[model samples]
Target: MGIKSWLSKPLASWIVQKQKKWSSDPVGTQKNVFDLLIKKAQKTTFGKDHAFDSIQSHADYCRLVPVREYEGFKEYIELVKQGTQDVLWPGIPLYFAKTSGTTSGVKYIPITKDSIGYHINGAKDALLNYVHQTGKSEFLDKKLIFLSGSPIMEKKNGIYIGRLSGIVNHHVPGYLRGNQLPSFETNCVDDWESKLEKIVDETIDQDMSLISGIPPWVQMYFDRIEERTHKKIKDVFPSFSLLVYGGVNFSPYKRKLIESIGKEIDTVETYPASEGFIAFQDIPGQAGLLLLLNSGIFYEFIPVEEYGSANPTRLTIGEVKTDVNYALVMSTNAGLFAYSIGDTVKFVSTAPYRIVVTGRVKHFISAFGEHVIGEEVEQAMKNALLKHPEVSITEFTVAPQVTPEEGLPYHEWLIEFISMPADMDQFAHDLDQEMIQKNIYYKDLIVGNILRPLVITSISAGGFINGMKKMGKLGGQNKAPRLSNDRSFATIILTA
Candidate 1:
């Protein structure tokens, strides 16, 4: 074997040992991280305002700083934006991870010198875990592409600002730089279509062993490759072995992406956000990503059903139970305290704390009070895939039809198909059956005749793509919601 194949051996072993050290004592590890974060931020403006010095426990924390979203913390962020020092964390933030928001126009999440390693290490440990599990690393030496946002960034108030992916782009470890593909200039193109075309030109004929991106954009890249080369990705790059993805559940996109690749390959799922890196899948085929207990963050969870209450029951690591959905909250080294990042997760394993991202807090269907969530819809689709091998779905979304023109209200599923089922009525029947089985409320609604059986709307090929482009969310971390409480997305899909 070449020397490159051996490089991951020691690194993987070291990472595994380090992870085991923390995983072995999940509660204590998190406690230490919590104390360190609180102790370090005591002098900052936020800490002083929240009386951090007097806070002694999670109960004290819950009382001192109420749970909030980005808007609630915008006061400190604004202070930092105006050249305030020691406002959020110690000194000024090194970078602001600029990300889009539905309510807040543009959010600037702070990252400090002390906190930068969380994002960097989050990526590293995930890849190393893959290496240790598979006993292979030669993919590191071959050409690879990270289909990410442009690396180019700007400075605001003397702090660098860019997408989280772009901020991390500047920090790609030197060892991997040698094999990174799609030249920097191409990556900096800004316009996704133009950048994608340039990326195809740069790497189509070169050796590419790894590709990483959100599923839809990655699918776009594969489509472009097949269009140009007239070959499956497996045939074009036989050595390609790993596919790393995150930012969306993979089940809906799984069959389509695998077919494009033309074979099975190892895949890794990561849970990363501007707030912090939450988890990574540690074992192959495991149900959920292992939570980062020793990372520079203190975690909190509020039962999803109780989140809207004036005083919700907040639980820390040791207090949480398996299979219960909770709204993920965190207080981080980056200076977010009791902050809600809008994601919901369920712990599949509590002994070592492994969690599956169930859905987003606001992304659900309850127009008729059925309260169907993203996870239920995705699980139903997964069952559909297993039941109907001939049916291939490319993209799909669910929204409530509260006021149908003729009949009682119902849920509408818009699906874009690559291969249609021979029996359209039977396909809808199977999908509805799974959906009803997964969500008890939906089943109740159906039985009471408050809502009718869901209807299916077939979308032409590239329909969702055209719709996303129109919404200006066509690439780089953007994803179509699997379920929506409103008809905004449904309108777009119908028109597209």
Candidate 2:
């Protein structure tokens, strides 16, 4: 038997057993996880400061710890950077995962030895979950490719720092190394173009069966592969049976991805962040992801409307209701407590809980109090595409033009289209009308002459990628923000 087959049977059994336990008593399991975390770190500085030993219930924990963004944890993190042990967790962090977050420009998220277990085990269980649900194990016998960040890390004080994906690559299990593609040397290449070319050259002839990456870059890689071989991706890898992705809504890029594949393949969505692995698609044909309840992270939800207020109500997993948009707050083994991760989600199921990412907390344009969110803008674009049936957007970002000298203030969309529409004016009008229909505040602003109709700027070829490159955020796991409060990205795109 192959290594995967030998491993899959026991793993699948474990996953099935865990799922039954979780579904049977989700509330009891959640409370046990919370209690274990608090007990584990009661002697640490963060816990002691917050009276963790004295805390007796969920209410006590909530009342003692205020929800905070990374800025609030900056001081504690600085101490970690200087090699302080047992500050946040039991010891200094194993490493810090760096990323470009919305509020904090360059965020350094801690990854403790304990916390890394969650990521590693979560990934293993996710794959096993797929096997348990689908009864498909042939893909496990072939090579799989993950287009990920460079694993090259730089030392900060005594801690290593790099992208989270890169850090995880260094920890791939020994048994599964043969199933993974792209040599370590190529993966460490700094430039994306050079790395992608090397990867295409390395894995083009392998018995590749699965691929995973963020959607936009995956499309770029597939296009490059097809260009070189003069064949579609499926032709190159006949065994390619699954595509795994996350980090952005896949709906906008779905048609293009399917066209590139040229064949039917199962798609699995995962919800992983630098902070922790949250959820993954477990069942075939399921609409939402199964929340990783047993992972080493404690979750809290704050109603979207209550966010940015002085004191938002923080609800535990037991208290969360289905279909309500709530900003995600997490406390993890990495020593982050009651921390806001800046993304929003809506629960689709309460028992054996599942959720779908709704939008981002910081990605919105509310200059004129329209309070437009990423989901609203994306849905509006989707509606416009449905109506026009001729245009396709590769990428887009919206920002406010508050002080345009030639026209009234408006929301400007800088877009890169795969196929341009015949009449740009009508296309823009359709998007504006769709937006008004979706958001009452946007409609009121337009009616009051407080804001002009939305403006569309057709970006030149490679404009968005070039802008991302210039901003030093051009590769794996780093996605361009869908909306920005200021015109920084808009100005860059216009001038690029």
Candidate 3:
């Protein structure tokens, strides 16, 4: 924590008070928030009255909006580039948060002055709340290390630009910025191979106290560091206090990462995006609290259910139930109204609205007419890993593919490990058994022999995510598809 962070307790209280006033009201709060956004959106040339309508008018407005993906927003981004004031918000936007989605190559998401301030202040509030909940003051004095994307601004026509990278490069507090190590931008490495090398070199001598980033990148950094130093990260950053990360599920990699760190570092998950910072871990022991940026955006949830079901129920903050998954829809300060992010989340509680991200709505495997969700796969995998004491899985990937001769669909598990059972057949059988016990659908499918179980051991040190990173598709909001129902990439991996 920095000096500003220490002084932000009052600011945190102010934000909380405002949040309480808004969140507690529920119905009136949402209407007010939506109305405010509508007033703002009405000013934009692209905005229409239908775009700003309520959740009940979703069907009517959705067609008008036409589900504009990030690519559709590229024109608005170009308008920003021209330094025009005709884009989503008033005046020139501060910076763009670069994020990649399924089809969008690289989305330069506009972050207005107000949006940036909201994110910065929200971050402060979250930190201060963490301090209050944990009953620890050590964080206030320790140096924080944010494992983020390099703050390299791209020069176009002699003007430096690059939305997200520029924001982090320019907006970080000056004092803390000076103490930070080299970013991916500082190093002359544009490709993953050299970038990982640079990351290893920069942190070798730093007195890092906290680490934060996407889980896969963190794993990659530690793996590279270990290879170079012949010591785990615990040996390198002995004073490390916390591991804060989000952007993907951490449960699968938690055990290994904990072991590598050697000491029990406090773990915190943040549900942030290029669009906005939606939620953060408020209390230390409690699950993450969905601190709705009430002033920043309006939110709605659609109950997740099987296909061919009745109309999905739209939920307000008050209506959300614990332990049930919901598809999130948002209308943000930045022009995206009634936007579906394609992610799924389950509420741990409703009063404070704490949620644990269940999985991706797009990343489900439904072979043999059985819908196997990402959470189910993750839970089953975790359970299977717990059964073996000697085996340690560092990373893994699952792809649904059809067997060559039989033309039958099956799941191919690509597992990377430190050690494994010498009898490969027995290991496979045990893993299959564990999966069966964990997920009934998978069990029934296996029992019916519609999907044959298979596992491939990768000898490569960095594992599947590293392979994806090498292809320039890792970090930020982009993640390696954990459950690929499509057989395109699966067939290649299975054959290889």
Per-candidate TM equals 0.98, 0.96, 0.84
Q: Roughly what TM-score does model 3 have, to 2 decimal places?
A: 0.84
* Candidate 2 ranges with C-alpha deviation above 4 Å: 1-10, 155-158
Poorest 10 consecutive residues by lDDT, candidate 3: 157-166
Candidate 1 lDDT, tens digit per residue, 135-167? 878888798899998888899888998889888
Candidate 3 lDDT, tens digit per residue, 271-385?
Answer: 7766777788877757665656464877767777732234445666667788887887777777676566777888886676678888777777776666677887777677666
Q: Give lDDT for model 1.
A: 0.90
Which stretches in model 3 have alpha-carbon errors above 4 Å?
Answer: 1-23, 49-87, 155-166, 183-189, 306-313, 406-408, 422-427, 433-444, 454-459, 474-478, 489-496
TM-score winner between candidates 2 and 3: 2
Residue-pair clashes, model 3: 2
The residue ranges of model 1 lying beyond 4 angstroms of the native Cα positions read none
Model 3 residue 465 CA deviation (Å) reads 4.9
Q: Using TM-score as the measure, which candidate wins?
A: 1
Best by lDDT: 1
Model 1 TM: 0.98
